[model samples]
Target: MTLRAYPVRYLPGEDELVWTGGLGVTVRFTPGVEPLTMADEVDLLVVTPEDFSESLQPLVEHKDSYGVATRLVTLEDVYGGVFFEVRGRDEAERVKYFIKDAVEEWGVRYVMLVGGRNGGLLEEKWWCPVRYAHLDDGSNWEASYLSDLYFADIYNPDGSFSSWDTNGNDLFAEYSLMSKDILDLYPDVYVGRLACRNSYEVEVMVDKIITYETTAHGSEWFHRMVAVGGDSAPRAGDPWYEGEEENKAALSYMDDFEEVTLWTSDGSLSGPQDVIDAVSRGCGFLFFDGHGNPMNWATHPPHDEETWIDGLGVGDMRKLSNDGMYPVCVVGGCHNGQFNVSLLNLLKIYEGYQHWYSYIYKGEVSPESWAWWITRMAGGGAIASLGYTGLDWFATGDGDQDGIPDCTQYLSGFMHVNFFWEYGENGRRMLGELHGETVADYINAFFPTTEKLDYKTAEEWALLGDPSLMVGGYP
Candidate 1:
């Protein structure tokens, strides 16, 4: 299956293009200081939209006070010279070049995309870069999905471009999205997106981050983890049923916890009300493992012969008044964190080649999509989230053919390791570091073993909140 590119005139609703849609800037980047340099290795870089640049100061300062090194810069600084020059080049590619330079020159560890994405209209606004990732190597129509993993996987180990285009097509990040040789697979650097639409949304997120880190609210609640499990394999007796997400949730939450409250699809905890109530009541962290779509988290109950429950959606999440008490929700489900690209783009690229459209077209654009809505809610939602951007694969998550329960799904395992292993084992208390550690841990596990690199399944997931937000220990 080949990705067919159309000329500008051939595309429909040309005005709705999000990429290359930012306003032109006349001035190029002139740091004024001779050759830019940072005395210490850079740990975090905040790329804010020009409009919301100043408002991010407090957040950056907060990150600094924690002894975590960070720098905040506007898109203009990187793009330099008139808006048209920035427009002339693909913003995503240009941004990647900047990141590549930072990685090589400044010893940068993490990059944060500070704005949100708008699905309705693709007018000039904050940038939300998109990448084309392959699901499998074969002629799989569904193989090519929209992703932002391209930005994360910058180079190959051989010093050549892994380019996601293993076939060496001019189209870099396409089918066979990431090459195992791309050490970035372990992700040399971590990335996160704040997903804020405006300065107000930015305010809401920053407030949550600062308060969650500084205030002495219920210190007692910080250790309380609410683990919600979803559907088990359609048929219980089967060894492997859709990756055993429900089972993973229980063990993952209990992985390092002795006092945490673990909720499952059991009759009492699987209902929509139960999940919402749990989130509303607030907890140190939240976990959900089950089937998911952009619109909602749906699961089939193991009980009744054929009964299912309608799980919570982003709209339902917005309805929650968790006050200032927010939990870092780590969801092990598909499309749980599909921030920028959506089902529509998924369909457009694979439209003629696949028959999956009917089942895949469940979500629309930005404001309505699941990931951005929850993380950017006006009052309370997750301060940060670690979830999937596209369909999550379960079969090979634990090496494709391992025994049931013994095997781990790609994302499920990542979250489990992040909280259980990475937290104290690696000493990463910041969300950004935890996220990077999570992916790195997963890569370390699968790497060196000769296991085929399955970047799509894991790379599809990402951090949907502020990268610098602290994980557990508070200041």
Candidate 2:
């Protein structure tokens, strides 16, 4: 009676054993002996680099205290084949395979990726590597952008791995006029990220999550939802202020929360100063409907003059004094969620700006995106933020061809406003549930692959935060 571990594979003549136990065995041997398994039954799985393992323990404990049944697995653990066999073309796919295994064995509902680049603003290294989707919307000159959705959409419809590499060319989610890879955009599990470069940032986030869950319930500030916008797309023949209309639609679902409108039509959204003042005061949630880049989030006024009314920037993060009262910010704009921005790209300026050059790579801008700056703010900022990692598009006129106007659709507005709809109307309290369900709902309604813009829309939208967060705190 000895024990040994072997990679599960199909035997040439042996039939696969079918069982209803806590394991998925591909083959069985050794009569009268049960196999060992990692069947701990996890509700939330935290994946991070070994360096941040100690820093994330508090978050693990806090989640457990709230009956979440959390588990923390390091990159080293998965790569070393401690719990699952290593497989995939790259590290990103390997991590995704681990997620699939977790779902099948431990029944994980939420996953939190807890690491980012390893060095300072100038020097960088990916601790937890990300997958870049090559879904070209024809307008995206860069052709690729970081997407965490690949990790969440673990399985395809028929229980096969949703590798996002359908064409088998190793180009994941590649979509062009000539080459295309069909994908099951629906998420098998909800996922989020903490893009922390160091342990201090990890500590900051852990404390924020713990405090928010333990103390945020029934707070008056938590009852107020702040909606800020102007003219997101000031187009002729379109409405004078489309952003305000979008915000109003989002506010319609959140009827219980106090509506704090700071729109340009009301003379409230004049500049960044107004936004800073409001954020400093704090609120339960913040919806910023406008145009944005990695450096800043801004929009035009009520008319179609195209005058930019600045809302927030990475530099203004220090002015936030709301402290523990962080809102889950949903910014509707382009590149606000582009977490792949690197300061090291500044050195490449010697190469003249070409087709691949994105404006976000400017040397003067912050290395991190606006939404990340908000989430990583030491004391006052957002607990989480959802936005597009690339060029976000709104429906010009019934892009879906559903007969009804496109503005009435879900992703056409703030896009993530469906997150609010999930929470307010559907009663999805967990942050990731709202986030994942929003994506799933979009996929269900749009049947994505039909339009390139639709496919890019779902792929680029990303959530940056803990996925298992209890919305409005644990009451």
Candidate 3:
């Protein structure tokens, strides 16, 4: 796949957040000495780097209208720039302790990390540390993934030690080594992340949040969902695409909602203007599955019989007709959550470590991953999006042509279905709890097993927006 350049969307006054700051500070607090009081009675705490801490106040204030007692704190404010020198502990332990204290002491129910998780490589202490998981991959190699679940997994049943690195191996999120009693599959404290790389990006996001929340939107508009499923594999020889049948099956959970099925638009994924037009009409939820990346999703729109994939992308955000109404988009695609950019990742792409699953790979122009761009779109971005930071694991059969190769046996479909079921059917509202509940549901369904695929699946997927933003069910 070749890189494609598309027109970038711009929001006026977005340049105000550009700031210059480098890693040249000294560590302040010593180990076992985070002298912070957890006496503040707040429901939501927004965490950011100290540089952007001032600007975040406005965003926090705007979110305050939502009736949640929201507060803003810098990582330094929480950690005092201290690096915990414990096994399976690092700078991220600061956030862990803060959250633990908030949950234990204060009435804090939600904690939102409001900056990028990509820490600077060379530093005595990490900058905006992200929690990590050490799950063994199916390939037999140990795979470490960025996980927010760590902060939420604060204490064990005994409430003695923070069960980060069990077996004292100094590795956090090693599910195999960690004691089960410590693990909170259904985390009591809800968690979220902003995932912005810079203050400018955060500013843009803040503007969107203010505009979205301040304006009154129709509840029925949100109840109207749109499901788009693209070909999982090249339907070069056949007319109909793969993944639609099962995707439609998964979409059935939202049967009551006024929805548009793009996979079977006029009965197939090849409908000419179905999805492009569907977005123009407002909806509460958007579900898409198929070959894709952060830049673009694959679709055999209208013509193009030889599986010439032309699909939606970040560049198309400007052209979208949806203005104020933002849906919660769930993309069952690969690498839409690969928010960080690096030259080394290009090399990984060549080595198949970073698989480019779509036709239109991201070029130099687009600001963030298409997955995130959906939420931050100037016209109308969703409240939240869930996608894979890496490959969305799916089970494939051994050249079986007897029937439709049902990939729904994979966790991707189950999670996708469970998400809708949690929202549409179960009447659950908040994104993070829904995410946790879905993971817990999947685990409960497939318990008494050591399947690496299921474990790795939960580790790689993430939510890309506000977790506490409740999508109050069908009005």
Clashing pairs in 2: none
Ten consecutive residues with minimal summed lDDT in candidate 1?
6-15
Which candidate gets the maximum TM-score versus the true structure?
2
Candidate 3 residue pairs that clash: 88-170, 222-284
Error of 2 at 263 (Å): 1.2
Q: Could you tell me the lDDT of residue 46 within candidate 1?
A: 82
- The true-versus-predicted C-alpha distance at residue 283 of model 1, in Å, is 1.1
TM-score of each: 0.75, 0.87, 0.74
Candidate 1 lDDT (Cα, 0 to 1):
0.59
lDDT of 3 by residue, 1-475 (tens): 1222222211111212122343354535454445334555788878778877876778778667667688777777676634322232456775777777666567678888877634332321223677667764544322566667667666663444456666666666575533322244435567877777667767777776665565525555666878787556543454444456455665677766785777633554454255667877878788887766667776543334366454577666667677767777888776676555332333334435335322124431234676777776566657678887666766443222335443554467667877877876887877777887787676655443455566657666777777667664222
Per-residue lDDT tens digits for candidate 1, residues 1-475, read 1122222211111212122333443544444445544445577778777877777788788878877777776777778833223432366666766776667666777788877554433233335555556545353324555555566667675444335555544454343435422334545457788877678887888788888888524365565666665443455454343323444434453434333333344455556777677667766677666667677776565533266565678667856777667778777667777665443454453445344454455464324457667777767777777777766654322232334342243435444534545664655666767776666666554443222225565567677877667665464
Give the Cα-based TM-score of candidate 2 against the true structure: 0.87
Q: Compared with the true structure, what per-residue lDDT tens digits does model 2 show for residues 244-267?
A: 777777888998898888888778
What TM-score quantifies how close candidate 3 is to the native fold? 0.74
Candidate order, TM-score descending = 2, 1, 3
